[model samples]
Target: MIDLTKDGDLWTVTLNRPDKANALTEAMLEKLVDIAQDASAARCLVLTGAGRVFSAGADLDAARAGLATSDLWERLSSAIADLPCLTISALNGSLAGGAFGMALACDLRICARHARFFYPVMKLGFLPQPSDPQRLRDLIGPARTKMILMGGEKIDADTALAWGLVDRVVPQDQLRGTVDELSADTLSASPTHATAIKAMI
Candidate 1:
């Protein structure tokens, strides 16, 4: 589940399954896609998860049910990656498995100091489809991505920031404020200018 709140030109999307550490479900992915579509009119977007984690990744039950290949999840991932607004993933806690894809899809990532990053799909006997390999390489370069994916190691927030996987790392309490300030800064730009600059990148 997810909740969407709007404040002026900013949109905040919160993953709302704290009981399960916000493990992503197929329905949740569908709603995420819908929210991203609606965010087209906003100047900035912020994504965060409820409770202690940004997300633990895919719901194991759903994954076991073969829902990973659902069209909804694919569409949601693509939509988030292509969102026109400046999108930021507020990594307030650990991000694992498919959740890494969600954060990587964002234009920028702001993480809490205590956060950890991992992609355990291979350990789960599954490979990330939909071109996650290239996205990981683009975010952190091939060598680092290979180390993380192949080694199946969990990296702390500092290491992730150093590797360019996260744009900023701050205290847990500062996460939301940091995202708010960054979103304001992003929204200050002309939409055309922002779009053009992003296109060039």
Candidate 2:
């Protein structure tokens, strides 16, 4: 499930199905796409999850049903990347599989200390969403990207931060507050101003 919360100029989209480790279904992916498309009006948009795992990627049954290789993953991440706003992935816990696209697309990623990052597409016998490899490479470089995508390495939050995959590693208790603090300036800025600065970057 995807839950969207709008607060003034900030919009936060959360993965809400903790029971399944927030494993995504096609419908959930579609909702994320819709929300990202509509979030252009917000000055800041945050992507996060409801529980201990940010997402385990596609639901097992859904993956078996072809959701693992769907174009929707590309569409969703592309929409988020195209948004003319500051986008942050507030990773609550471990991030894996297809879910890597959204985090890779974000302007910044802040994760809890215990969070881990991995993408097992290579091991899973599916190519990653088209843009994911390049986005990930841009952040952490090709060799390190290969370490995860090819070597199937599960990186800890500190390693992710060191590699530039995540911008910050905060205590879980301070996660929301850190996001709020990071969002404050953009939230108060004129949308046009924020968009302009983002474009310049």
Candidate 3:
């Protein structure tokens, strides 16, 4: 469900189950959390997906078999949020369901120009972890969060940028290069300043 790779200063964690829309299983979630928690030396931590969809969030089918979605989600999101270095959600494609929380927990989110950001919890008849809505609120605002979680508005890359949901958008072909540049720029700050600024922010 996930693949992790490290090259010098860059660490990337990718959701690999493209055929499954990158839906996260409990085990997958645990692994992701572990990766984030252990990423101290990396200058940049990137979360992305392998195929056309970034991640669908919790695996509903697994949940039917008793996967603890709320608990696992809380752990994973919290781990990402606490990463000391720059954390970027590199959305290669659409993001949906609980995956929105994953993206929001990152310090920055950059997406493909055509990618969509969807929240269908209300339509699916269940709310995500209690803290998820708040994370979304922190990124955008409570009002906009309500519009998505309650009012049922759909968001594309453009809309997400306008609402401050995503930090940048690039053509699909240029996404990797864009993220590479940004990662370099983020790491360009002096180590002390980077850590201090990150802490202060």
Candidate 4:
């Protein structure tokens, strides 16, 4: 359900289930953890969706089938968040539910102008993964965190950029070039400095 490509020190991991809007399954999250462990040599790691819809969130079916999808997802997000290299979430399309945590876990988020963002835990009556609220607060502050967690607010790309949920928003066609430029700018630093700053932050 995912594809990994490496060019020099850049590693790109794409969620490949376009037909399912890239909805994350337990298997996908497991693969993510494995790839993340192997990405130590990468200068940067980019996470994105294949066709569109970065991810619709955790696969409900898998959860219903007794898979500990949320636990696995939490582990995957933590693994990515702790990566030594610069990390980016290229939101080529909208992100929702657990996907929001994935994007938030990234050091920087570059989103498509039309890409949307939201978390529906309130609406679904489900408690989020243990660390999600703290992660949300870290990105957008406590008040905004309440707005999303309590109010179930849905934010579009422009609003996401303005609200500190994303670092940049680009039109669909410019999404790739924008991410590439940012990646190149980040990678220009010496590896020592790059990994140091990543850990410092």
Q: Estimate each model's TM-score.
A: 0.94, 0.98, 0.93, 0.94
For candidate 1, the TM-score is 0.94
Give the local distance difference test score of model 4.
0.84
lDDT, candidate 1, 1-201, per-residue tens: 799999987899999999999999988888888898788888888899888789998899998897665666556667888877888999889998877766778898998999998887667887775667788898889988888888887899999988998999999899888987877756888888787877788
lDDT of 1 at 175: 87
Point out the higher-scoring one by lDDT: 2 or 3: 2
Better of 2 and 4 by TM-score: 2
| Candidate 3 residue lDDT tens string, 1-201 | 679988777898999999988998888988987897898777789998987789876688886665634577777788888878889999999998877767888899999988987788778777677778988898789999998898877888999999999999998778789779888866777766677778999
- 1-201: candidate 4 lDDT, tens digit per residue: 899998888899999999998988878988988988787788999999987689988787975674433577677778888888988999999998877777778889998888978888888777777778998898789999998888988888888888888998888788778878988966788999888877776
Top of the candidates by lDDT: 2
Worst 10 residues of 1 by lDDT: 68-77
Question: Candidate 4, which segments miss by more than 4 Å at Cα?
Answer: 67-69
Q: Please state the error at residue 105 of candidate 4 in Å.
A: 0.9
Candidate 3 regions off by >4 Å?
none
Instruction: Tell me the number of clashing residue pairs for each predicted model.
Output: 0, 0, 0, 0
Query: On residues 10-124, what C-alpha lDDT tens digit does candidate 2 reach at each position?
Result: 8999999999999999999999998989998888899999989999999989998999989999999999999999999999999999999999999999999999998998888
